[model samples]
Target: MKKRFRILVTGSAGFIGHHLMLALQRAGHHTVGLDALNNYYDPKLKFRRLQEQGFNTEEIKYDTLLSNSTLHGSYFIQLDLADAPALQQLFKAQAFDIVINLAAQAGVRHSIDHPEQYVASNLVGFANILECCRRNRIKHLLFASSSSVYGLNQDIPFSTSHRTDEPISFYAATKKANEVMAHSYAHLYSLPITGLRFFTVYGPWGRPDMAYYIFSKAIVEGKPIRIFNYGDMLRDFTYVDDVVEGVMQLLDVKPATGKAPYKLYNIGNNQPEQLMEAVAILERLLQRKAKLDLHPIQPGDVRATFADVEDLALETGFKPQTSLREGLSKFIDWFKMYHKINEVHALQEG
Candidate 1:
């Protein structure tokens, strides 16, 4: 029988974090979710995600546990990772069996403008997490890396073995730094750590800042949707469920003791989709037309991203399986409902 472990999922209000928290709860684990609930995009959306996980957003206070009514053995707290003392207290109190560090300032473009946010959250916050894990003697620590780390490689399918020193964006650089930092901790502290290099994950309750969500909104509102690199980008769009499944599977599979006690894998769909193709599918799903504003690729943007999931498959016996059309359809359905969009008006008026 599989052991029921106590787990901590940082960034629990975020997209992947929310889905992963629910999955862990369903698997009968005692789960504690923590999020700073920053205003990078919208705090309301983050609160909504917390609410979905049975947290009372109105009653939430920092460093306080909000028990879940619907899901037993689940709890949440609003806390910042940058607060070392608070984080230390939480780690001491919870003594989690596993820690999944998903808390970080996301978005390459946003990082270009707000480098300080990236440094504080991605670097400092992550350092705090590592310290806590080491102090608590956590059994396993799984953190989110990014496909962006493969910047300027020109490799068709980015592999864990490939060189990643030349990150094109500040965001990617921070993630790359995370990989090396975690490795150092693993080597020194003998902590079992795994870094998941996630591809373009999307689904219901995804971040509004993503290209698909933004394009969907603009298309429905009859506003112009900007296509970067003249719609000549490629992405390995992995679905949320698939990503969650991979994480769940790897939860029990910790790194070996002798091999630096650390490992990295690309959790992505092996298939890459063209940018225009994805937009077309979204248009079809929404039954709307998009005003294309073709432009050169913005700074900090990559021309393509394709994940080499061979290592992931070998390690976890899983790979992302959701097709782009199916995933986008689910996202569109959720988007309309979340935005309270009337289908008739959205299609005909736009």
Candidate 2:
């Protein structure tokens, strides 16, 4: 018999968070999703995601629990992690068996402009979560790290054992701080923690800021698409489904006792696809020719990213199975339907 656990997933309304929340609900787990739903890109999309989970966006109040109508086992709360008092109260009330902290101020370039946001959310918010888990006695703590943590490394495939001391971007630095912070909590409180360094994750319900999503929209609207580094970038684009699968697999599997029970792994597709090749695939799928706008590599942008998933596979016996072409096809289908590209030539014209 499978054990049905009470899970707390932070950032539940975000791209990966929404998918993960639905997946957990479907699997018969009592899950609670928490998100501030800040206007990083579009709050409407975040609200839409919450709405799909049976939350009425208009009625949602901060720090209040919103129950899912369709799935009795799911709930959502709109709150920031930095609110220590509220978070502590909720943690004490729920007594969650596991926590997956996916909430963070994402985007490297955005961090450059708004370093304060990263400090507030990624640092202070994360600290609050760690303290909550310690007081609540969470069985296992899993959080999202990033491939950006491997900043400036020329290594083909990034590994967990690699030295991530020198982070090029503020976003990456904050993530690295998360790993160390979790490790300290694990060491002191004897908490079981796992940090997953995710590569370029994309698929249906993807973030609009991502290159693939932007490129798709531009191509559909017959607008020029900017190719950074003159289309010389490489990325290990892991599909969202695959990332969820990896998370689900590692959910109940706690790190071995002793040594603070701290573990880290890279969750990504072992396959790295070239940027131009991916654009070509998008063009083919969308049936449109993209006007090429070549540009130099932007600050805080890495030339390439690949993942060494052998450690993850060895521990969990799981590897990402979705091919890039197949994943893009699914994304394109969703994009067209969701954005209503047929109704208008440009959804959000720049």
Candidate 3:
């Protein structure tokens, strides 16, 4: 099979997007990256990632063809999925073989304060993507769904067959909606769609809003970290490399159809570790202790998350091998170098 083909990857400037694009490029695939470059967190960081990947930083604009260059014959266009006509035009121009949709308003807590963002990005934006794929007759579509869909299931290891109607947050609800929407398109139009329910993904170039990044930043700066749920939360923290690898494996593997080509799977570490356990690991990695301020769990927060990866293993040979300790160590090392933190004393005295 010729794995090297034109692939359209949304959220290409994001943490996972950046890593996934690099992986595809390394595997000799021609990729096209599209991102809104919104100031959701920091556009500078996004641009930096693009620059690191050999994209010309100076040419990039909010919504323009910043560059036509890449290390692996890749292309980039500054586009938003919400713009229906613009997205349609891009699909018309590129004729993408496969699409991996990773762009969405991401944080769970943020969704509580700003539910509209979720509706716009996760709902409407996703609809646009589906429309484009159908019109272009794309071979396959893969999207990023969250483990948050498990909501209050209280299941030990979340399975694909589990009932996911009880979503605790607006964010989780929107993700579940995306799954339903994708399944509908697959059944209606014969579009092969696969949705991956990702667990707590943390590593280098991660989102600033994520717990590991925020907590680590606070801990390093001697600020009191918000230890929510009295530090009783647990998560299946999966590493970035494992995530990209699993996604790469699915490039050639389209959703199989007995009746319709629609499938969903959970991609995560089978092990769930406590919030405090993760903090402790971070502390050990940074050589500094956290000034913990334990508090009650916030709204839209879950007590635990675990993933059942049997389906993923059976389909793609996906296995998460990085331990929390090892992942945390690599993250801390990158964090220090990225921020130019000289010493533990400097980190503490800051």
User: Estimated TM-score per prediction?
Assistant: 0.95, 0.95, 0.94
Candidate closer to the true structure by lDDT (higher is better), 1 or 3: 1
lDDT of 3 at 247: 91
Clashing pairs in 3: none
- Report how far off residue 93 is in candidate 3 (Å): 0.7
lDDT (Cα, tens digit) per residue for candidate 2, span 49-126 = 888888786775444442222233777888999999988888877778999999999999999999999999999999
Best by lDDT: 1
State the C-alpha lDDT per candidate.
0.90, 0.89, 0.87
- Order of quality (lDDT): 1, 2, 3
Report model 2's TM-score to 2 decimal places: 0.95
The local distance difference test score of model 1 is 0.90
Model 2's alpha-carbon lDDT is 0.89
Q: Which 10 consecutive positions of candidate 2 have the poorest summed lDDT?
A: 63-72
Per residue, candidate 3 scores C-alpha lDDT tens digits across 1-350 of 55577889999999999999888888888888888888889787788788867788567543333222233477677888899988887777666788999999888988989999888888999999999999999999999999999998976889989999999999999999999999999999999999999999989888888899988988888899998899988899999999988898888888878667999988898899988989988888877789999999999998989999999899888999899999888888878877778854454211
lDDT of 1 by residue, 1-350 (tens): 68999899999999999999999988899988999999998888998898899888787554444222233388888889999988888888776899999999999999988999999999999999999999999999999999999988987888899999999899999999999999999999999999999999999999989999889989988899999999999998999999999999999999988859999999999999999999999989988888999999998888889988897788878967789999999998888778878846453211
Winner on TM-score between 1 and 3 is: 1
